[model samples]
Target: MEKFTLELLFHIIGIGAASGLIYKDNSLFVIGDNSGFLYEYHIDSQDLKRHPLIENPSENILKKEKPDFEALTHFQDSLYIFGSGSTPKRNAMVEFDLAQKKKTDTKNLTNLYEVMQNFSSIKPEDFNIEGVIFEGENWYFFNRGNGISNKNTLFKLHAKKLDQEFSMTSIDYKLPKIKGVRTSFTDAVLVDNKIYFLATAEDTQSTYHDGEVLGSIIGRIDIETMKIDFTKKISDSHKFEGLTVYKNDNKTIELLLCEDKDTEILETTIYKLSLNLK
Candidate 1:
């Protein structure tokens, strides 16, 4: 149990954040935003420098009217961007090549348009994809779960083969009901083989009407047992939207929490948390 200290802040509104420490000895991170822009940031001099990655070409080309960058993850030297709205022709995970600096292709795993046309329980508009994390051979997607009900849902998508069509299945997990908690699950990370997620919760009935005040907490998910232990709570104004684990010199683990200041018009901040992994 430890508190996070803010390291650096960048005023960028990103829907989701993804980072990877690869063999190049360079730390890479990608931030996807509502404006259909993906900005790549490199860690240098203890600051984040925005490097242009990719952006949606035109609104007319997209299926839905508004294409939001909801989820992001890195796999096989490529970054995957997922969302509900995308170009009508390709409305799934858009793969971006890190070395080429361009979008290679798109994969429509859910067939959102077709799913909405036929299904009743799910709809294209109801899909609010947020953050993604790779665990084992499967990639878990965290959905904001329909802005109406705000039900937290995790979708497991198999991505063992890049060219293979991914099959998605839902997993069960209960969102914490804390007083003044407004937002649902935002981001997840694996630490010591355990999954920990960060979410924002605020009072919907508050008179202040200042949007949702950000709060954070950590929960561990047992993969084998299919159980979530949310006993640890983190209360901070920084709204955590992404997390990454790093090893220190002494072989200790440090969790890097990324904050999404989308609504507040604040700078994006990253916090480092020293954890006691026992």
Candidate 2:
């Protein structure tokens, strides 16, 4: 593994609790955990635009009533936003049309989530999903181990088939610990058959509440081997929950990350991380 460096890119005000990020065509698309708006930040112009995803007068929803959208991924012309599935109310998937700039479809993943919980033997209180990866016909959901179960697992299923009879493949991963605190999956992206993920170590063991963050790490898993290739601590202060590849080449890989400060502040900081591959 090569040494990684971090740099401050910019900040997006009023987009607090930024949880999911995707960058394409020089525009950064972001979704917050507590907000009902999709934000687009243009890199060249430095302009920010917000598109409402729900009917809200204040543009932000109450914390207790929010959908808790924690993961974002796009397929073809639509961007899929998924709830954390920590509670009964957070079991929805919102599909936003990228071209139309509006919501196109919605799905309730309650049955699927319940089945995963049962198969994984994870208690209801410990079943928080924080990340998702959509590649070809497979969909991989990353379940955080922040709760009592402490089982960082990856669930894979056929994306085109959602019937109840379809079986899901469950794979467990033991993330490295930071300062004696176990790290849990936050977000992931698949590139060239390699899966890169972000994991954070928080102080608390409950998935419903926030805790003092110990640190965050970046790791990789090769699809062919299905094993952890490497893991390295990225930050000891910022609790990053969203990750996207900003740029990649033969020598280095640049990633863009969004931080969850666990506060009521109306701003989010975007960081640029560069990893030397040589």
Candidate 3:
């Protein structure tokens, strides 16, 4: 692996760290899996602001409980945030109209998450998802597999309306595993129409939530050829959860990698990763 400077962007003080990241409107937004609040960071001013998801006022899709927001992305003029559905909760997506900063749509993705959770071979905890990317008219949902029976399943949803009524297709997408190591997809991003993954392996015994951090990697999936490559690996202690492209010069691009400790540290981390992929 080439040496890249891991520049700290923002250490989330108090509350929990971020599970997903999105860069839009000259700002960076991070989501908490335990909390439904979106932490916004201004690039130029370095201002950190917290905003709560406005409850969908309509009783038809009104949810009293805060969904565990896991994935964040931007499409057109709106920002979409998704819940993990780790425990079969009302898996939904909250869409914010960036032009108005108002919750404009509420999508119930329970049918998608519930089917994966209730699969005969996978357990509810093993069916967790953290990686999601919106490209073209399809939304890619990656389940964080524990290397047990699951192989980082990927669900492609053809979204016509950003909500509940979409067709979904699934496939078992596998990442490269170190010797006897079971890895999972933490997050993903699409650059130049190609998909790159933030793959990390933890030393968990498959029956736990958090585990000893082992290895981290930045991988790529050539959608046309349908090939998954583990191009670079990071042997650090950081449990990277989110990834976004920051700078794309002629030669190298800066990858913004965010970390979630999953502990009571009251702080989050973002590292600027530089990769010279020719």
Candidate 4:
């Protein structure tokens, strides 16, 4: 793995905290951590549309009252959005139908999240789930090491069911530090057998509070071995939290990333990251 190039694509107006991203059919689906709407940005036309994920008003949702959607993934024909589960108020899973362009169902993941907390022995304050991806009959949940414990972990859950009988295995990782702050997982995308993930170095010991951004890192984990192949620093100014693959070839991979400035600004920028795969 080698250094990657990044380009500013365009700005997504009115979305302050773009935490999750997914690209499909020439459009980008964005989820804001402090918003009640799911946004669709057309790449070719430069048009943006907002679909309400819940009954509340889209952008007016308060920060403390928002669902804090931190991860997004497309499976089958629907999009699954998950909360960070850092707090009791952030334990919701929303399923949006792609064809219908509406939220079909929302699941309260309190039980499932509690099970994870108990199994990993992570305190409620340290259990911040920042990313999730699925392959075959397994779903991988990423726990950010931004809290007091600073434990970055990957929880693999067998997809038999989301009940007490389901099996789970965890792997802990120690990410590189940036500007004296250790980086932690923020988002991930699975390409073939390799999982590409984003980690950001924020100067905060509490999960509920915002902090100074040190930088962001991109890394790859080999699924077969469940180990990291490489980690690279992509940016030293922006705290990118969302990532999705736009295109990939034999020598290069094109990815789109979204960032949370940790401010009240009502706009977010989408960046293009090109990785050299040779």
Worst 10 residues of 1 by lDDT: 15-24
Report lDDT (Cα) of residue 264, candidate 3: 42
Q: TM-score for each prediction?
A: 0.71, 0.96, 0.85, 0.96
Judged by lDDT relative to the true structure, which candidate is superior, 1 or 2? Answer: 2
lDDT of 4 by residue, 17-118 (tens): 889999999999999898888998888988988998877547746768878899998777788899999988899988899999999998899999998888
How many residue pairs clash in model 1? Answer: 8
At residue 164, give the lDDT of candidate 4. Answer: 37
Highest lDDT among the candidates is held by which one? 4
Candidate closest to the true structure, highest TM-score: 4
By the TM-score metric, which is better: model 2 or model 3?
2
| lDDT digits (tens) for residues 1-278 of candidate 2 | 76899999998876788999999899999988888888888888889888876666244467778888899987777788899999988898888898998888778999899999999888899999999987658888999999987989999887653543565788899898988999999999987888999999998899888998999999998977788999999988779999999999958999999999877687989999999878
Error of 1 at 154 (Å): 1.6
Which regions in candidate 3 have their CA more than 4 angstroms from the true location? 1-5, 10-15, 54-66, 115-123, 162-167, 205-208
Error of 4 at 131 (Å): 0.7
Clashes of each: 8, 0, 1, 0
- What are the Cα lDDT values of the candidates? 0.53, 0.87, 0.70, 0.89
